[model samples]
Target: MLYVKIHQLSERKFKITQIAKELKISRPTVYKYLGMTYEEVKQLLEDPHRKARKLDPYRDWIIAWLEEYPHLSAAQIRDWLLERYPDMEVGESTVRSYVRELREIYQIEKKNIVRQYEAVPEQPMGKQLQVDWGETKQKTINKKEVKLYFIAFVLAHSRLKYMEWQNRPFTTRDAIRCHENAFQYYGGRTEEIVYDQDHLITVSENAGQLLLTTEFQSYVNERKFKIHLCRKADPESKGMIENVVKYIKGNFADSRVFSNIDDWNKRALQWLERTGNYHVHQTTKKRPAEVFLVEKQHLKPVSSLLSFESNHEQSITRNVGKDNTVRFKSNRYSVPLGTYNSATDNQVYIKIKTGKRQTLEIRKQLEGEIIAEHLISLEKGKLIQNRNHTRDRSKGIEEYKEHLISRFKDQEQGRTYLNEICLKYARYRRDQLAIIHRVIQEDPGWIDEALTKCLKEKLYSANDFRDMVQYFKNLKVAPVRNKMNDSKGPKHAKGMIVTTRSLDAYTSILGGAAQ
Candidate 1:
């Protein structure tokens, strides 16, 4: 009561005993009021008016600047304010505090204002799993280069993580492979996989909704797994996996030197088992591995569909020859002798199949029937000539002669004469010689007859042999009686014709002609 009377007086000059006696209260109560001085009373009265010390003198300007550029950091704002007002000294902590206050106020009044995201409640056990790609610096297999990119996954409740090295560019194949590997590593599959909308898995902008890629969706459907895609750019939606990535980068990958990507992934898995799974979680205070053991019972058993199946479609095309064979990748693949002449109006379609190795199989489909098949090689400038149809004659005369002799052993004399003609033509054009050599190999008996006819006609050029062959096919012989009459008499008698009237006369004439 004395303390109350002292507070009512607004003066601190009263003695503790005098106040206690006057108010008839306990001495301790009087002592409580007498402890405060006059200045303390004045300070208490003016508490509302004591302007809160400006944590940042230029806070208003900084807030306005931040409104224009939300990405600007506290240090950046401090530097900018110092530039504008040389006398205004602002620390990064003060700027951060002002921005934080602005954020809190904006969040309270404006529902649409961007704020720090909080993760949604996760279901217990195998209801959901989070997946994400994490990157860490690592040495390559040859120890000559450093690379990055590691795909990581985490169970929502248990926080048990699965990770693997993905050193190459991200693709649909890589995404599917990572999912299959992660499920196997976890020993079971969750009911659903929760993922941030990555282009590799989603393939298209979801218009602010969830949409999975066709290939990825097919993969999930085959295993009877549900697909859950998070909002775009919201990494916290799959916070468990994101946190695992950060933790692994800091605890394992930062200081470790791995000889290869496999080695790095092996070390990461070991660390997850030893450091991450065995360690107690900060909030739950339970070992992740122990929690996972309970969660494992809820997970679905592994499906029979193993990973790494071929997802490629097949196509086919026919290659038209530059001369008489189809050429692909600098290699000549032969078709039948006149196949191209009949296929002038058709278009050839090529087929491609996808797997660990890219296999390109070329086929010619005519009237829905495959006519030819050839394999393509990747070596530059290497010719792949079809040995079943043609021979390479680029080696010169001795090689050509040996080839001709081997093909025409039944007519050695004729083959020798043809070799002489090929040599004579080789003096003018080497390619012409190869053509002549091929002609001789095709029919050796035609060589001696062609050469003797050429000699009788004084043929010297390669064209002369062609002309002589044409003439020999068209040559006509006159009857012997008409020839003798023309030799004995005049040219006028050549107009008369003789005909056999009886079968015996005609038979005698046929026998003489045959002899």
Candidate 2:
């Protein structure tokens, strides 16, 4: 183009008149093509050559080397080129010009590549909001390590933003809570929320389709908000929030110090009110608060807050043996003796709440009757064993020796037998002989049943037998009566009777007893 040639000539130190005479055109015409005023041409002729150098054949090699080693200096590159071509001597200035040209070409190539991506236009204001998280560290009240997470929210149209920090680790609960807080603060709800692919909200991707987490989906559905997840590694898709992150980090967090997460968040809110809301955006030339006011008019009214409880319910079946002791998971838990009915063994439900940490809360019911309450064990992954199931195994052949001796104080034979039983059952401790004495005092009949059950079951301790006794006390001893008695027995039992009998027989045969 003529303009290109005019620019080249100007860079080459050609006078405007000289250029016009050479091209056989008027000076005004030459000036028009050059895109410069007469005064600009006068200044250009007085200056040094500003023409861009032509590309060299070896320039690509030089660029590749520099890219591989960015620290390489001009002198170093000159030496490298000389070594490659002994006869050629390239000046450092020429190498510099060539490097600059290569850099410009690369930038232009990158711009052209990015131009292929089309940006989606913004629609009505407050129709969508962007979400993200940033992190920093602070000292807690106890001077312990505390990593704080900042939830960043930005309006899609106006770029109005808010940030808050929490000490707890980010989870599905926190995600839902943050959305609730943002909606409350804004006094309205956007139809859609755009978010980076956070694992709490979006679980997995298959062929570019996002699978939302069950909890996250339910939360959004309750609020009537559509979710749009940006492509992975595409920060520009949510540029508003990304810019807000930079602004907050530089302006609010950089020089701030606080004793706790709450204090830091309070300070962040103050900073947002003072700086973020009032400042005019460089691109939009409107204050964020002003723009947000316009956008807020378009937003839908905020819905009533719904209960955001996590959904991690599970059914726990306690295994109770004939001895009346129940086994929870791997740990043995004991209830009152004759309190648990075998038919209701599986009715117990253990409610687990997983938040910043996992907590277990258990509820027990036997035929819909509340029998016992115990604190859930705090052991990490280890089942809590019931202490009531321990049984003493040292008692021997001299069963009622201590009792008989107590009645006849001077009976030597009874004393000897009592000592022998204590020695056998209590690891040769005379004190253990007193346990037999106490058992006789309570109920002598329980000793044999308890001992026989412990021995038969190979129970290791006296507590084990105790747990079994408790389990029996909680169970129903009465046999269930058949509701429909067959007068003809099974000769001609048909339909439901046959089906019920068959199912019961199959269950009994397979040892598959229901609760």
Please report the candidate that would top TM-score against the real structure: 2
Local accuracy by lDDT, each model: 0.59, 0.59
Q: Which stretches of candidate 1 lie over 4 Å from their true place?
A: 1-119, 139-144, 205-211, 307-515
Tens digit of per-residue lDDT, candidate 1, span 383-462: 55556445454666666556655643245653555555666666644444444554554444454456566666556444
Which regions in candidate 2 have their CA more than 4 angstroms from the true location?
Answer: 1-120, 139-145, 307-375, 378-515
lDDT of 2 by residue, 97-215 (tens): 56644543342121111222235576578788888998866545565656667889988788788877877658666777788788887878888888887766775666777777656
Q: Which pairs of residues collide in candidate 1?
A: 315-350, 315-351, 315-352, 316-349, 316-350, 316-351, 317-349, 317-350, 331-384
